[model samples]
Target: MKQTNYYLFDWMDFDESLSKDESLWKAYTSTEVKAVDGDIHITVPYQKQVLQEDMLADTDVPQRDYILILRAYGDSIVRMFTSMVDDEMKDTGSYMLELDKALTHKPLSVEFADNVYTIKDNDGRTRARIDITPYNTEWWSDLQPGPQPTIHLTVYPDGNLAKGVELSDDHFSPPRYDALPIGFCLTEGKPDRATVSFKCEADECFVGTGERFRKMDLSGQTFYLKNQDGQGVNNRRAYKNIPFYMSSRMYGVFYHTSDYCRLSLADHSSRSVQFRNDRATIDTFIIGGETPERILFHYRQLTGFPPMLPIWSFGIWMSRMTYFSADEVDEICDRLRAEHYPCDVIHLDTGWFRTDWLCEWKFNPERFPNPERFLKRLSDNGYKVSLWQLPYVANGAEQIEETKANKYISTPTGGWENAAGTSGASNFSTLDYAGTIDFTSEKATEWYKGLLKNLLDMGVKCIKTDFGENIHMDATYESMTPEQLNNIYSLLYQKAAYEVTKDVTGDGIVWARAAWAGCQRYPLHWGGDSESSWAGLAGSLKGGLHFGLSGFAFWSHDVPGFHSEPDFMNSVIDPKVYMRWTQFGVFSSHMRYHGSHKREPWYYPTIAEDIKKWWRLRYRLLPYIIEESRIATESGWPMIQALLMHHPEDKTVWHIDDEYYFGRKFLVCPVMNGNDRRDIYLPEGEWVNFFTGEHFEGGKWYRNVEVPLDEMPVFCRPGTEIKVYDEKVDSTDDIDWQKVKTLFIE
Candidate 1:
């Protein structure tokens, strides 16, 4: 759908934010205007804003950041960045990635005309206009009186802003040692981590904080943007932490900082949203669009896009905790053939090497006596093979000494120094065993990739790039402090593996665990270890949805979580949970049936028929999935999208996480909490249930949408066209794509 001009709409999208009583658009207006050098400065008095509250007049008011001039990025974009200068005029530069350095910087041309400061560029288009106003008086910490300067941006063609900072009057503030001092702020005596909130309805919410396991709409919750490796459904620490999020407010905000930050949506403040980065400067990009999907696509232009994968990668991948020996692998292949189940890729997880969880690239001779013959046998059985490995060289391994000898190991620091208030103190999961590979050193990356390449030559098709989150913050790097490289370490590790694989063969992909902004440059990523329960299933889906909105298009999860560990809470999943999780997985971009326990359909005979049915459906719809994968590569839209992305105008879809649009056609609502039914909200159109072919009108809720244990609630929207294979195919290499039948619903 083509985007509509936002200016024509009577209501601003942000009005749906939790702060419904006070509209951000209605409360503030242009007052005074001036052309300051190359920028436009417009000011608005606070008597019209929150400062007007009668109840706050007696109480000591907190200092608020004054709104300043606006900068236009050529035609389609505008930006706001704070250059923090202290009393001495000393400044702290931005600590985030300098993304603008790579883009075209079009200088702004400012002109004063008709009492309004007109801001334009070389193209002679009036991008924005600034009208200044008398500043409002603000009370500082010592009850000092001061006037606050204000600036407002008018995105001429109507395309931006609604995200700005407001300081809350609070005595308690977190220590930000890692951030350059900014108590002395940009004009307004705002707190170090200041805030700008959306006055939205209760229904408005937030989505992308990469790889969160809880609910998708993070409206009232406060999560610190620190990359701590955590497990379980409740733990707040995440393996992937990218400080970027898309809002139901119809805009995208990304704080370009590697430091700790906090974003609150009508949580602490009764009527406003907030943003506080650990650093001194608040450098961010606010992208606007008619729909969340288009905003995401524009956001992708700043971050990187997901890489394309080989066609065969879209097929089913089978794995267990170990698949230890060659004979065990062969027996599994033989059993799949006996059951007439379609299997394309088989993974040899941990214990395939000399020792379990050791980053040894060599295959264990005891387990696989002959790697060559085993590879040939699997190839003959129509299977591609993948091996597992991580970046750490285990302490006792022979390669540990060898890796250190060659200066590849990360040198230990005296201790964890440079603690960043909360991140360094609150979360501690320090690994004592091995040193991480120093990827900043090109020699180390090449050495590790060389080892992986040697294995790829032998038999392994791809490596399950795992466990990159637990880097030693004290470890030495050639350039930046290890603390600076902490969150992005996964990218360096995954990039080495991906680039090496791509160099050797024409194709490469990694089923990785963690990521940052540009990590999507590597194709595939999977959810980390999850327990075997409905909550875990929901968490995996939630995490995928969150990660997808962050520009990482392709994502997968442990179909039924690998819930068995010697020390952790572990158990085989209830058959019902496994079946339901598999139903959701079947529609995902990449399908994989994996777990610590025996995940084979034969092992759980009760759901065997259901399992086979879903597996066959995966293959039958392979051609359609492959085409969608191609579209995803071009558009940066995920194969699985929250219903909110496709139907932003329909407020009902904003809160739905259990059901989402799969590949732009089907609304898949997986049964959660072991319920035999669920409530599904279909957005504005006609849709038909996949199983019963019963049609229903959209824009209404279907209560008690009966979803049996054997069935997942999937509905096809109108104007859908896709391919269906006539028979179950064992491997993607064998399927005749030209012969598959196509189905179109108009």
Candidate 2:
């Protein structure tokens, strides 16, 4: 479907009204300052223009004053908050910040001299400088609103006061009509909205903001920081949106809010990066680092680190859109083992309930007559059962009336009759007028968990927490308004599922699709709904690379893509696409084969042997993958790291998005296009090809490197040792730890 510009259709897609007009925007002028507990707090009274016959008069407009707080976290990270209502800005009571327990809050010293406030760290090194002078403000004309006092934030990323870089506000004059004075402006029409603009260098690049699929460098793009049903992996719509970005200038900015916002990174204006939020406060944390990895490390410290997943989750998972009956599942498992394909999990998607996609949380007795016995049978055979469910209760679901009566569902403020706003529900064809589970209510969460607990008692090990993106904005919740709960809804929903799974199985895991900032604590998530094409494969890889940079560790995508051309039922996926996608899936942090059609390798007979080869290699490398996952959990690094993360000094590798480091050793350049050879860039290290033991020089691009269909282009450092299972195993449970052997790359 074509995207519509109708503002009322999808309000999340619309820009905030404050960015439209400059005259309605106002700034708070600094009046006084004080220090409490070594933290600097400034009081800026709100200012408005008094127009008499279209002429400005020196008159004060009495309104609430704004409080700006500046504090330090350790020596590198600084928190800045600007608000009118609260003395200190607080999170939405959301779980976005699960700060590391070892994070120390250090007191920063502030000094005022020559009309400038300098903030220094414990070592007395300058961290930031604030200027609130008349020169920092902008105006258009005599009839325009006069300049108000604006706080100009200049940050010293290197802790050198002399080398401070000033993030630009809007530079507006009469002839510069392209410029809008949106630099730190509050909307007069709606007090809840705010916009902040920062100047960007001409050649600056940025990456992150969670699971973006468009490009690796977000230099000239605009991304909406809100979760939505992307429909496919080829669009700007994202299932995971984080309001944080790492700049090419060796600094990071994390916008701390749960409200839907827009991040224009040099998109509209070539020299400005503007952030507009639907919230009243401008709260952000600026982090300084010498490398991108260090920036991500501090980011993970502010939020939470990724949890270690179970050993079996690293193995191949067999799944499709709908696995209907127990007999069909049994046949697939039998064929998988018969064909010597190593598998660990079988996910039953959207077909486990009495009606397909009904999500009643009950097994279809006709298809799965004995849920417990069936799950135990699979469990005994070394396979885990992953059940699929969502947070929405459909209209015809058996538990809908119960959920409504218990007030476990989010209802419209004007009642259910006024539930017609588009929250991207039409993407999923079978969706009905449903009630979204009110995860904000503690009672509602417990009630929802009780339903899953029944299924957990029946031996299901994993829960596929799907579809937390399509939330109605006008709906009412128990604790927060819909706007407040919009972005963080996925985090809460995934947390409930992860906690319940751990409560039963002792290994917390949820195959979640949607996410926010702190969703990494839930262990695993996947790229959503991709087309079964080469472009789909490329797009999915780009999304994963950006997601890894955005503080997530484990991520997967549908093998051979999720949706085929035209439709999933009628189109036959190309055999080469399946083979190459299988190779890519085997190298990811978690591997799963799923699509609209039957995704079993046997469907494509000619390439079935090639697909099995990749599966066996994955099992052989399971030990290495598990150890790397442990490191990823402890450190903030991702399993599939972008090339720039490992070598920030190598300027040539900044834009190379197609290749990534699988763990710390292997550089995986997937065969996105089916060809006999591809170009590979070895970044500043001695690399040995994993397949043929061919040597390559450092800091050079190898064009058209000969690669076969059954082989992936993987390179590792010389003499790098990785553990591999020396024997064939049908599943992760069958692997003998004693038989693991370390293989040297060189």
* TM-score per candidate: 0.81, 0.92
What C-alpha lDDT do the candidate models reach, one value each?
0.67, 0.79
Per-residue lDDT of model 1, residues 1-746, tens digit only:
12222210111122322333331111134455445554555453332123221111112333333344455543344555553332111112322232333334445667776556776766776666655434454555754333223333444422343432222222122110111111221213332332333333456678887887767688776567777666654468788777777778677766666656666555554344555654444555666666777767666656666768988888899998778888999999988978888888999887788776554788789988999889888988889898887777766567877776776867666422431211221121232345778888888888898898898887678888877876756567766577667777888888888887777766778888877767787869888877778778888888888888887788888878767434343465688877888888898998887777888888888989879988889988888888788888767489888888787777676677778877877788888777688888878778987767778898888898676788777889666777788776778877987788988765
Candidate 1's TM-score reads 0.81
Highest TM-score model number: 2
Model 2 scores worst on lDDT over the 10 consecutive residues at 5-14
Which regions of candidate 2 are displaced past 4 Å?
1-23, 26-31, 45-64, 85-87, 132-149, 157-165, 172-190, 416-426
Q: Tell me how many clashing residue pairs each candidate has.
A: 16, 1
Estimate, for each residue in 1-746, the C-alpha lDDT of model 2 and write its tens digit: 12333211122222333244222234444566666786767676554433221212224645446677777776667777786434355533447887776767666777888887777777888877777655654555576544444556676744855434455534343212222222223334545556666777888888889999967778988787888898888888999998998887777888888888888888766777777777757888788777887888888888988889999999999999889999999999988888789999999998888888778899999999999989998999889999888888878888878887888998877786666643244355455746789999999999989988999999999999988987866678898888888889999999999999999989899998998888999979999999999889999999999999888999999998998897655598989889889888888999999888879989899988878888899999999999999998888689999998888767777688889999988899998886757888888868888888988888999898777787788888889999999788999999888888999877
- The CA-based lDDT of model 1 is what? 0.67
Model 1, position 683: C-alpha lDDT score: 81
Taking every candidate in turn, the Cα RMSD to the unseen true structure, in Å, is 9.2, 4.2
The CA lDDT at 23 in model 2 is: 24
